[model samples]
Target: MATRCCIAGGGPAGLVLGYLLARSGVPVVVLEKHDDFLRDFRGDTIHPSTLQVLEDVGLLDRFLRLPHQEIGELTADVFGEVVVMADFRHLPAPRPFLVLVPQWDFLDFIADEARKFPHFELRMGARVTRVLEEDGRVAGVEVSQRGDTQEIRAGLVVAADGRHTTVRTSAGLPTTDYGAPIDVLWFHLPRTPEDPSRTGGTMRPGSMLVTLNRDTYWQCAYVIPKGSLEALRARGLPAFRRSVAEISGFLGDVVDRIASWDDVKLLSVQVSRMPRWWRDGLLCIGDAAHAMSPIGGVGINLAIQDAVAAANLLAAPLREGRLLPAHLEAVQRRREWPTRVTQRMQIALQDALLSPLLARTDVPAGVPLPVRLLQRLPLLRRLPARAIGMGVRPERVRLPPAG
Candidate 1:
């Protein structure tokens, strides 16, 4: 099969790019290795930047109709005290709040919309094994599906296949690992009507737990030092359950739902980015290009922004067959700064806050001074709100839809 663009990975970046390209009359196919988008613990927070893109594409109203919870502000419980972190209500956008919906629902919505255009195709369970190259340019992909492998040539190939991306590695792209001091163990617990409505987490000396309110349940991420899962397991599940209950006392005995280690999913957090994101007919976006820390839950939004920028810069060129190496470089040039800025913030937070917190052995009596200042000066909260909500250099949809 042949098309204008073949995108590896059907996550936020690839699907959104495919949808936009197809809208612009570019034949595009998105290959997802998974049969379904039901994987647990994916980033689900849709920020204001992404919401603005949806509005520009005229899909905001339809997207709002989906079942999702909105968060106006981000708050965290530090040493048994609630600290207001980011206030999203004042963000400059049509939807000035963060939307929390299951990632599968969001992807399905994009896939459904893209199907309206004749040029769009989505192949689920299609795993990309290698890049097809010719004359020193990436030509297409060798994809495996249902016990058969075949070549699908394209004008361009996109490696949106995430951090452990086979496509990017196959093409021999080099990545710079900034390194993370922590990993997260994720699990779910029952949420009740009396449970806190605001989405946030709890932090204590030597331990931290992030709790995202998923309407029916709380999706919890328990942060631990890197390479320490074995030590934690040796301490036993009952001991782990006690630690969780102690930090977020409101959960009470509900923590018992974590029946065994199997109930907890390990997320080995990695923060790294490729010095160069593309070469010839290939480009890498989202986690494939830069793997982010789960600090502000901004990974999904960043990936979506990359897609919007890529589509904006490359759609017309690909449709007219005037694409060049310079066009691909423009995408990296447009997005690389934001990726670097965001990763810097995440790494600083990891080193200055998380690393020290996890290493401490004493219980603190009060919230940190920074938390107190933010709580005291309500106006200061918007700084963080703007950073998390708007991001740096948010992209707008500029490609006019082709009839």
Candidate 2:
């Protein structure tokens, strides 16, 4: 197959780029390994930065119609008290809120929108095994899908495959590790009218349980030490539920829903970024370029921001058949700083806050004095809201919206 651009692993980055490039009348094919977007435990929060991108492309009105939960402020419970950690309500943007919609729905909406453009093709279940290189430049991808193997040829190839990306790793791209001391065990719990009014959860000794309102149910993430999944599983589901209940009594009733260890999904957190996101004909975007810590839930928005920046910088070049290594380099240069700044904040939060608390043996009555100041002072919350909600450098739609 021949295309102007062939994108590997269709997550937020690939889909957004494919949609944007196709709107410029550039041929694009986005290859997703999954047969469907029903994969669970993915980043579901769409920040205001991403919401503005949709608005710029004129898709916000239609996209907002999808069922989602909106959070104007982020709160964290310390001991027994609720603290307002960050506020998005004061953000200087059209959508000053974070929408918690199922990731599958968002991806499907982007894919379906992309398909409406004549030049876009989304190949579901198409697993990219390796990048096609010719004379030290990326030619395209080698894909295996449903027992069939084929090669896709393109002027430029994008790797939006995510953290465990095959395209970048297959090409031997080096990543600088920032190190993460925590991993998350994610699971779902039943939501009831009798539950606490607060949406967030608590961090007590040895455990941190975060309950996000996913509309139908509570999507929970229990944080644990790095490389502790085996020891945790050995302790069994009952102990896991006990730790959850110990953190927040509202979850005591629904701990029974965790029938087995299989019900708990483990997310090994890593914070890292590539020194160089592009080489020759190929470029890396989203989690493939930078694996973010799950602290602020900013990974999805960051990935989407990368997509918009890349499309804005390279769409004309791809459409005009003048795509070059310089174009790819420009994208990496444009996005690397924001990725660095965000990852730094996440790592600092983990090291300075979560690590100290998790290492303790006794439960504290309240959080540290610095955190208390953050909660008590209304001005302090906007700092994080700007960083997390709008990000360091938010991109506008430089190209025309797809019809």
Candidate 3:
């Protein structure tokens, strides 16, 4: 009999897993709660590492054709002094930069690709409320569609849910919260000539602008305190616009372009890691397993990497027999080291950007002059590209061969 895998939460991770598994001839089902792909303000940036994985999976061409933007460099402004942190042009790949595509479109595209495989099934509006266990092994999931509940029996259950993962909690796994004190206030602004290049723009001082198109708009994020969204909304449109203008000097024109309160959206940020990503016959991937702060801009990329790693490792064992704890253990071990390093880096970056004074104060005044000089060198721009390009290598991670 063929292996039956049920994937919970049809986000990028779940959808990609379904696509790869179905292509390898496994029967796969993806359940998503949302009735349609209409979410806004999701992470739209796809790092170079993720792009490489998409190319390997044969979806790069399609991904490129979607309405999107390319990011070339990341810049920082410290007390009115400009510094270039990472430049994508220096990376070795043909396409070294990050791509900014709306998450809804990307998810829809992946779902469409998964549909081409006869073994793949995507059921939107189907929400998995609980995992089904038989004899201490994950047998499947109990899901609800509209008002009706049904049971899906499968050999393996993969959870690709986001930070507040229901599956992770259901399995009784412990999650460690490494909270960052900042949150993100997201909003859209109309395109302006003063904005960075439409295709490969760099973030301007005091604001991060992701240009969507020459004529359409750009997405921006402003760092704020956690739980500040409601207070910000209560401040009303004028105050909100003023706050934006204060943070981003260039926002004078863009604030006027906003025209209405409906254009802005806010997201509270938090970073967390699951102590145990797997239990019994089930496996957790993506933000469900390791939630990272958005400061490093690697959340989506990491999630995609997790999907690739999990599929590569578990596909074969799942094909031959029931999914085992050993297989899940291997997945966690392969991902934990990279995940921890990246999370720590994220905290450091957050400190530098959001609390520069605190970061600077922490450094010794008597630090070596040569080290400070090296930090100011312009050649350091390649660092971001190098970091973004480093994703999980299937060979190193010990993934299974293609089915």
Model 2: per-residue Cα lDDT over 289-369, one tens digit each? 999998888999899999999999998889889988999999988999888888888999999888987788887766779
lDDT by residue (tens digit), candidate 3, 1-403: 2238889988888988888788767788899999997888787888777777677766788789987777686655433434455678876654778787888888999999879888889999998898888888778888899999999988888889888888877777788998887777667777767655533222323333332442467577666656666776788888878766654566567787667766766666788898888888788988998887876577887888788778787777776775678888998898888888888878886766555432233333432343234357757666655776554342222332244
lDDT of each: 0.94, 0.89, 0.73
Cα lDDT tens digits, model 1, 354-398, are 999999888777888888999999999998898899898889999
Q: What is the lDDT of candidate 2?
A: 0.89
lDDT, residue 194, model 1:
88
Model 2 pairs in collision: none
What candidate 2 gets wrong by more than 4 Å, as runs, is: none
Better of 2 and 3 by lDDT: 2
Best-to-worst ranking by lDDT = 1, 2, 3
Worst 10 residues of 3 by lDDT: 392-401
lDDT of 3 at 310: 81
Worst 10 residues of 2 by lDDT: 196-205
